[model samples]
Target: MSTSTAPARRSTALPASPIRLTVGGILRSEWIKLRSLRSTVWAYAVVFALQVAIGLLVVSVTVSNTGETFRGGPGANIPELATLGATAGVIFGQLVVSVLGVLVISGEYSTGQIRSSFAAVPKRLPVLWAKLAVFGVTTFVVSLVSILIAFFVTYPILSNANITADLWDPNVFLKLVGAAGYLALSGMLALGIGAILRSTAGGIAAALGLLLVVPIVFGLIPADWSATISDWLPGNAGTAIYQSSRIFEWWQGLLIMLGWIAVAIAAAATLMRRRDA
Candidate 1:
């Protein structure tokens, strides 16, 4: 029986081309994902508005204080305080942005969307890099723009109080940039904590503990080591970037802050690799 089986029917569907994972592709995907979330939009808007509004409030307070000092005599040299009010909003902004950072990753984990992400990326680390890159760039740009807006708006108000600072001045410019950088690094640290914890509440709590509470607790302790450690806490180091009276130089403060960020990211990456999605 020389019966030949009929040729198998050909698939009308085209063979799927393998999707190549590139850094650019990953970054674009992350950007779209970040922008699509309504929470992301609200979070960023609130952060920018709150920061600028708080900066205005700080300038008003400073104006009130300066009037009394001017009445008494020539006010003390508070050149540092001249630009301080403009950037003061970053204090509140950092907290808000950090929370957003935590939500960025933890939200994914909580929703079980992370499995699809891991499946797509496969290697895993690319997703982390993409999130950090997209989030960090977004954070820095938003923070810098909002802070600068506050800075310019504060100029006329503060100038009337004889507290004007030239933006062209190196110190003024550096401090402004430093403030923005501080928020970026702070956000990155928060994201890393989120990745490690994979819970929004836990991530925020740990981040707040590290950035706010731990330093205060250490300060309350009387030991010399406690004082030294407190001086070098991430929050303190971040403040040093803008505060001239700090123990460490600005560059040193920046390095210290960067070190904290690096360590946090390393820990997060390690945990991310070992943990189950």
Candidate 2:
């Protein structure tokens, strides 16, 4: 009778509830996560290096070949000239931004940390929004700094070539700021796409295809259709804002880019809200 009673069964410990999401907290967390990565640092380094190198190369070529003759139309305009010089490396720098953008979300999924992230911020949309916010703000600031550095570095070279230009011209200011904004928006667009796909390779492929390959392929098509098709391409729209002569007006190009960003974010938000951690 003394041995008939069974020992008391132990209770299993329950898992703790997930953290509540806050916009500011999530943004801060994302900021730290982004900065902690090697890719972000490398992207900035690459952008800085590429800008300097391209600026120097352009200066050397222009100086050696131009024979001290200033280029036409607002090559005499100081602000436009400054903007052109400042963004000379943008084509290359943008690739770095694309990589960083893709890595921001795709990297989390690749590492299987998406679960932890979702656990900490169960409201998935806010997490995605926080990422978009972080990338947008950082890309803008970084682009601005990179362009400024490029401008200063390129200035002496342009002057050395006797290619006189003004950095204070109003239109030039518009182009300069516009270039940074375009790239920043493009970066966030990529970030949204990455979040939706949640795969680095897939994100990169889709982004590069949308940004680079599609444009090239479309350009090869007969002009009869190219005029209509080009306007819709992301790269065509994004870069149009930066050109001395734009296919679409700056605001038009901006709206096109905004459309892309909005569509991307909307799709990603839907997927995030519906998907499992």
Candidate 3:
């Protein structure tokens, strides 16, 4: 009777919940992967250096070439001039950012890391989205910081030459932010290309061709339609974000650039889902 009354006690412990995959966790993991790469560090460093160096060179040249800064009526354009000097480096910086964007994803492909990445996140697309978000934000921050530093660093030189402009000027501030935004979008475009090609060299070439070479080729065509097409291209349209353009307004430029990025990423996501790691 005692033995029967002592019938085995049931365990009260509940089964542990399985760990769930989340966008936040994926983003954190992608960030860790990005920062862990030496190439990422160096590539970002080069971008920063180029932004500052090229800015300094441009402002210095402007001061030296012009002999003296404009005063009175001519000084009306000082803010534009200042913004131009601060952002001139983006032309070169975009190239570096593009290469870095390619390497970020394609490097993983080159090694066997992508297989592990896909295995962990069987749904795959989250990985691409996470990578794009992390890399885009990092690039924008770095580019903006470098541009601001360049602005301040060259401010003294510009002031000495009587080319002073207020940093807080609405027009000037927007241009600076726009320049950084352009770099971010450009890099994301390249990242999408990298994901599609899964080859670093080919992605870099394709990205740069879209940004640099294609515009030149279009310009050399000597037709009105060619010129119009060139104006609508990502590279040409993007510049209107930071620099005044006859072809498109800044907002229009932003939309055009976003359109290109969206197309690239859409194509990339489609291919990535169908293909093996």
Candidate 4:
């Protein structure tokens, strides 16, 4: 039978489009990476505990020793005092945050996971931005919560000493927010350092040295320029965001800290783009 079979219909389906990378997707991926690490959990836990414990300790000591808290002389700025007590732990908590920040990126480099990350996102800068956003937001939220809890926990202690602050007061609330912002910003700065160094130990040491040792070294120098430079350092300037500073106002301090963070991140981004994974 030589019957001509009907020509098979030509397939008309279009090729499947490749999955596109997105900011949302990158952020989610970074979140997964951050939460998946055990160190993140432990580090955050320590931050929370330290904030609450130190707040309590400071307030308790203040009450027990003097039976009252005073800011200048007789009149105590209640809100300021409360803010101080709430943020007392940031000094210690910052060390942990700095280490965790360095670990976040350096761990990826150490374990060779950064290769996979870069492979997925060839541009690479998005990964750094995503990490910074996810980590920064998470840190700010956790820090704010911890600071609030510390405030509440120490409220009674402060109240007993006739030191009570209105949480609704803008001065008090803003200071708390500023404290959390400082932590987030500090961590982001450390993350940038980690990215640039690509070594956890070295990044942590450098970050900590810039934050702790450099300030001390500058302070010890017998020169006016050194004192001026020390005042403008990341650690010293950042503290002004939440605490009082004679040299810079709160907004000025925030701008200065942001400048430092921006410089760091810019360096990190440049290196990340130029260097191989």
Report the lDDT tens digits of candidate 2 across residue range 32-129. 98889888888878877887778667666766686646554433655555556677788887777887888899999999999999888876777888
Q: Mind giving the per-residue lDDT tens digits that candidate 4 earns over 36-93?
A: 9999999999999999999999978876887533533466666788777899999988
The C-alpha stretches of model 1 lying farther than 4 A from their native spots are 1-18, 68-79
Error of 1 at 30 (Å): 1.0
For model 3, the local distance difference test gives 0.90
Clashing pairs in 2: 74-77, 78-166, 79-172, 80-172
Sorted by TM-score (best first), the order is: 4, 3, 1, 2
- How does model 4 score by TM-score? 0.93
TM-score of each: 0.89, 0.86, 0.92, 0.93
| lDDT of model 1 at position 195 | 92
Q: Write the per-residue lDDT of candidate 1 for residues 157-207, one digit (tens) a residue.
A: 777777667787887887888888888888888999899899988999998
The models' CA-based lDDT, in order, is 0.84, 0.79, 0.90, 0.91
lDDT per residue as tens, model 3, 157-224: 78877777788988889999999999999999999999999998899999999988999999999999
Which numbered prediction scores highest in lDDT against the true structure?
A: 4
Better of 1 and 2 by TM-score: 1
Measured over all alpha carbons after superposition, the RMSD of each candidate to the real structure, in angstroms, is 4.2, 5.3, 5.7, 5.6
Better of 1 and 3 by TM-score: 3
